[model samples]
Target: MNIDISKEDFELAPGESVLIHTNEFIKVPNTLSACIYERYSVKSLGLMISPAHYMNPGYKGNIGLLAVNHSTVPIKLIPGIKICQLALFELTSEPLRPYEKQGGKYMDAKSASISKLHLDAEIQEFLKSKGVQKASDDMAKELGEYLMGHIRASAKRLADILRAEEESQKNG
Candidate 1:
């Protein structure tokens, strides 16, 4: 895909989505363009891949695939399964400037990168003006402590509930 999608060996619940990163990094030739589609196997399992638009010729990166779980239950992706395809189409003529040549934002990506929407030219100037400043040591510590307190409380509550449920079953 033009952008990066990253996921692996995940149990996707119904209405949940996953990002699929290709194991192999491929380099498309300048003379061809491609589109990514899921094979029939995925469809049979009630999974549908979001169709990626034309993989621009001369792209050099791991293909990203976004899949949605539509089945009633959770589904785990199995490895070594041919889940999708890159259907390459020959161009009438070679492109004067290809993906890598023009320094596309996604060129030579090594991992599943989320949408680089912030990097677009339109909003960059505004974003720069409101750019993030480094947090002070005390400020950082205070924020971290606050968040951690909530995390610990939530975790303890869940643990207590589970323990009670187990005890109830044993007593019954």
Candidate 2:
């Protein structure tokens, strides 16, 4: 769906992130799933969407995008820009139970949702079996730290490359 990001245009300071809703609401069939991706052009602008790209079958909702600014300066997200795309794939076979039938927490979600993984019965059971009730929280913190560190390092490397290019041009 084509959407105008004009009114929704947002600025993200370096290292900052925000959740943005897609202009389109999607409905997936039980026999199909989708992978969400950021448009390649956006990468050149120093913005990235989280890599959690998988969309479950039987989902009906507006996609929520986690936008991050990795550049040293703030990045302005303009409306009307093709921020993301969806690649749909056919499943080998339909599941006996689809997400909607199973009471998926994110069913019909209109906006980006925080993780509801903790509410999954299997996850709860696994945590109970492992005696690690706080695992989810701990894992989230660790993952955030790891990702931020990498982003910082990548930004530094890009800056270094730019500086080198400038110097080479001056001498050439």
The alpha-carbon deviation from the true structure for residue 97 of candidate 2, after best TM-score superposition, in angstroms, is: 1.5
**Could you tell me which residue pairs clash in candidate 2?**
5-79, 5-80, 6-79
Tell me the tens digit of each residue's lDDT in model 2 across 15-113: 888777877889999999998888788877788987657778898888888899988999877766787878999999998888899888778888775
Q: What is the TM-score of each candidate against the true structure?
A: 0.66, 0.66
Count of backbone clashes for each model? Answer: 0, 3
Q: Candidate 1's C-alpha lDDT?
A: 0.74
Off by over 4 Å in 1: 1-9, 126-172
The window of 10 residues in a row where model 2 has the poorest summed lDDT is 1-10
| Model 2 score (lDDT) | 0.80
What are the candidates' C-alpha RMSDs?
8.8, 6.8
Question: Local error of candidate 2 at 23, Å?
Answer: 1.3
